[model samples]
Target: MKTILNALAEPNRLQIVELLRDGPLTVGDITDKLRMNQPQVSKHLRVLNQSGVVEVQPIANRRYYKLRPEPFKELDTWVDSYKHLWNERFDRLEDYLHKVKRKEVDDE
Candidate 1:
């Protein structure tokens, strides 16, 4: 969880992480997607690499990045646990509204 939290700490890093959701991208591809320079992209990638949120592989002359997914899987599981709480609350509210509507019709 340390790596997951740290990886998501920065806005640029988060943007870069989200962009890599589809698949691996070269440095140039990620930079072009973000409208940033190569150096800036590398900086974010470095942080992600250190955090172990992403993996980098050198192919030919260029470096490519891919999402590690493990860290994000931890995050997803954490967030998913609270899903039912919101749904239950919304369901209650909907039932209450329908009851109120029926009461109004009866009074009319």
Candidate 2:
């Protein structure tokens, strides 16, 4: 998971992942869409592939890049584990706000 996060931490790699979210694309396609040179796009793709965030398929001489679902599913599960903590914090904040509002009304 750290590796996946590190890979996605790079802005260019994150953009590549966003592009792949729509569908698989070749290096050329990404380069064109991002207005970046081929070598730069390829480098980002390599990092994404090494981190298991994306997979490459060689079809006829072109490499197609697409997202790997497993990493994202793992990330989702990790985030979901913290949901209850966030909910509790939000509930406490709500209760405090209500108490403050009531105090203000009484003072008025």
Number of the top-ranking candidate, with TM-score as the measure: 2
- Tens-place lDDT per residue, model 2, 1-108, is 899999999999999999999999999999999999999999999999999999999999999999999999999999999999999999999999999999999999
Model 1 over residues 1-108: C-alpha lDDT tens digits?
777788788899999988999889998999898999989989989989988899998999988899997887888988888899989999999999999999999999
What TM-score does each of the candidates earn? 0.76, 0.96
* TM-score of candidate 2 relative to the true fold: 0.96
Model 2 has an lDDT value of: 0.96
Candidate 1 Cα misplacement greater than 4 A, ranges: 1-11
How many residue pairs in model 2 have overlapping backbones? 0
